[model samples]
Target: LPLKPTPPPFRNHGNFVVSVAELNRWLGERAEEAGAYVLSETVGAKLLVDDDYEQSGERSAGGEASGRDRNAPGRGRSTVIGVRTGDKGRDKDGGRKSNFEPGSDVVARATVLAEGCWGHLTGAALKGLGLAAKDPQVWALGVKEVWEVEQPLDRVIHTLGWPLRPQARFKEFGGSWIYPMNRPGETPRVSIGFVVGLDYADARLSVHDVLQEFKLHPLVRKILTGGKRVAWGAKAIPEGGYWAMPRLHAPGMVICGDGGGMVNVPKLKGIHYAIRSGMLAAETLYSSLKAGSTDFSSYERAVHQSEIGKDLYESRNMKQPFGRGLIVGGAITNAMVVTKGRLPGGHWPTHRDSDQPLLLTDRDKRYPKPDGKYTFDKLSSVFTTGNATRDDAPSHIRIQQRVPRELAEAWKWMCPAAVYEVPEDAPQGSEHVDLIVNPSNCVQCGAITAKGGRLTPPEGGDGPVYQVT
Candidate 1:
C-alpha cells in the first residue's frame, strides 16, 4: 500500500525556508568531522591533467601511485585567498597574481564545479577539452518575480497552476511559492516564475514578456491583486536530460548542480540532485586520494550508479515529444476546452505516450496538406491574383486601421514603402539613420504611379487614401 499523507501541525506557516549561511555552517561541521577540509568562497579554476600518468600500468590504473614530488615546480600546493585579509599562505597562492588567475583562489586535489545556472567557467573548461558543445535545444530560460502583497500575512497559501489556456503542456517546469517568513508586520512575499523552452532560435519571445503574461492570468491575478512587484529577474535553467549531459569526470575535476544540466523537469526538483552530486564527488575524490591514486574514473561510476542518473535517463525517454507535439497538442486541447467548456475526458492532461513523430507530412492521414498552401482551421489563408494584390501585402497593413489613431497615423505617413525611399537629408534629418531605411534608394514607386497611385504628397488630407497593396 502507498504511504498516507499527513497534515502539518502549523497552519499557514509557509513553505520550508533555510538560509545559505546556516547550510554552509552545517556542511562545515559535517565535513570537518569526517576529516575533510572545507573552504568557503573558493572558485575552481581548471582541471589538472597528468599526461605522464600512464594508464596501462597495473598499479597506476586503480591502486596507489606516487605522491606529490615536492621538488616539482607546481606540486603539493593548492592556493586559496583570504577574504577578510588579502594575504595568501604558502599552500594557497601557487606563484600566481590575484588578477592573473583565471578563476577563484580556492584550489584542491580534486575540484567539483557546483555553480548553479551561471556555470560559465565549467562550460569553458568542457568546451576546451572538446567534451561538450553549447546547444539551445537543451537549454531553457526562467523568469521570476517577487511580489509584496497587502493580504493577511498569517494565512498566505502557495499555489501552483498549469500553464495558461492554449499552451498548457508548454507549462514551464517550475512552481509558484509564497513564503510567510517576513518580519512580524511586514507584507508577505510571493515568488512566481516559469521555465520556457529555448527551441526557437528567434529572439521575438522574451522570458520577461511571458512572465508578465503569467501575472495577468485570472487565477494568478486574484492572488496578486493588491500586490506590487518588488523584484524580478531571468535565469537560464539547464533542461537537457541524459542525452545532453557531458562527461561527469575528468582527471582532477567533476561537475554538479545545474552546471551538469541535472534538473528533473517533471518533478520540478534539482537541489537534491545538486547536493547528492557534490557529496558523491567529494566521496570519490576522498577515496581516490586515500588510495594514493590519481585516476578519477570511480567518480564517473558512482554518478552512474546514483538515482539521479536513473531519473534523468527515464525522464529523457518520457519527455520525448516535449518540444513539438506536447506544445501543439496542448494548444489544440486548449481550443477544445474553450469551445466545449470542459477539459478532454474531464481530466487534466498528463504526460502522454509520445514515441511517435511530432510532425505530419503529406503521408500522414491526420494532416495531409497535398497542396502548396499550409492549411489549418486556426487561421484562414489569403490568395493573390493581380500585379498589386491584397493577399501579397504585409500583415502590418491589415492591422493598421484597427490600431490607435496616433499609431495608425504614424504608420500611414511612415509607409514602409515610402520610408524605404526617403532621402538621407530629408525633413527628418538623417545622421543616425540606418542605411536600410534610406527611402531615396527605392525604384519600385515608379510602378505605383503607373497604377494611378501617388507615391508622394496629394491634394487631399495627407496624400491619397493608401490602399493596402
Candidate 2:
C-alpha cells in the first residue's frame, strides 16, 4: 500500500544507464569529430607557473632571468604539465618505472578539473594555486550490482526503499531498486545500490550488508529471486549540496564534477551536472582565451547562472541525512502516478493528522540492563509514566520532561540494583557478581569469590538478602 499526497516523479528510469565502454566510444568519436586531441590514462602532476609575471598592477615575486626580456614586465605565461608515465622504467632513485614517460605538457590559457571522485590531482593543483578549501561535508558511498533474472522481462520497476537493519538509521540514507531494461522473453537486468551518509563514519555498516537485507524484502525479492549477479562495485559521491561547492575558479583554472563536490541529491544522478559544469568551464575558458585574458572569473559566474546551479541551490534548503523520508516519499509518489487511471477520482486522497507521533517508542517494557543503567532511560521512564497518568495527557510528551527525585529513585529500583554495584577491589565502578549463602563455617564457594571476598548478587537466586563486608 502507498500513502496519498505525493510529489510528481522528476526522473525517468530509461535515462539512468550507459555502459562505460559505450560511453568511451561515443566520447572518442565526438572528440575526433571536433578535432580535439584525446589522451587516456594520463595524470596531471602540476600546474606550471611563471611567477615572474604580475596580475593587473600586482608585482611579480619569482622572476625568471632568461625566459623573459630582462626588463619587460606584465603577467607572464602559465600552463599545466600533465605527466604520463612510460612503461616499466627507473627514476634517478632507481624506483620501478611506469608504462609511459611524461607526456607533452599542454599549454592553455585556462584549465578545467573534470576528474571524478579520485580528485587527488585536482585538489593538489588547487592547493598549489592557493584556491582549495577545507574538505566538504558532502560525502556518499555508491554500491551497485547488475543482475540477470531467470524470469521473463516485463515492465521495468525502479523501487526506492530503506534497508531493514535496526542500526540502519534514518539519518544515514540508503535505497534499493530493480530496473528491467531488456524486452520481454529476454532475461531482465537490475541494478541496486545505496549511498549512506558519513555522519556515522566510525560506525559505518558495509553496503553489502544493506544490500543482502534489501533483497529479502517481499517486493524486491519477487523480482530478484532467480537473478544471477553479474557485476558489483562501490564509489563515493560528494554531496555537500550547493553550500559545499568550493572555489569554482582561480586566475587560470576551474574545478568540476566530484572534484568540486557537485552531486545533486534530489536528482538521483550527477553525470548531467558534471557534464554541464565541465561544458560551462570549457565555454568560459574558450571566451577568456579568445580575449587573450588568462583570468577565469567568468567560469564561476557561468556556473552559478547555469541550470545545475539552480537545482543545487533549491536542494540546499533541504536538510541533511536524506534517508527514509526520501524513500517513503518517492515510493508513494511513483505508485500514485502509475495507478492514477485505475483509481476512482483519478487521484489518491490526502489528509492531515497533527495528533500522530512521527516515530513510535515502547515504554511499558524495561530496557536491557546496559541501557536501563543510562540516566536518560531512568529519567524518561519516570516522566512518561507520570505524564500518562495526568488529568489530560499532553498532546506531545517529549523525552526531555523532568523527573522528580522520588520518582527517579523508584524507577531506578525497578531496574536491577546489580547494575549499579561496584566491586570492593574493582578500583572503581567495576561490576562483579558474588554469592554468599553462609557467614560462619563458610563453604568458600569459588563461584562466589570476588577480587577481595566482596559479596554481590548470584546470577540465579530465589530470595533477597544483604551482607556487610
Model 1, span 206-274: residue lDDT tens: 333444545555756666777765444344556655555666655566778777768875544677788
Error of 2 at 378 (Å): 42
Model 2 agreement with the true structure over 240-259: per-residue lDDT tens digits: 66655666665666788766
**What ranges in model 1 sit over 4 Å off?**
1-107, 133-137, 152-186, 318-320, 325-469
Query: Where is model 2 more than 4 Å wrong at Cα?
Result: 1-16, 51-94, 97-104, 133-135, 151-161, 164-170, 183-187, 201-204, 319-469
Highest lDDT: give the candidate number. 2
Error of 1 at 107 (Å): 4.6
Question: What do the candidate models score in CA lDDT, each in turn?
Answer: 0.41, 0.43
The clash tally of candidate 2 reads 10
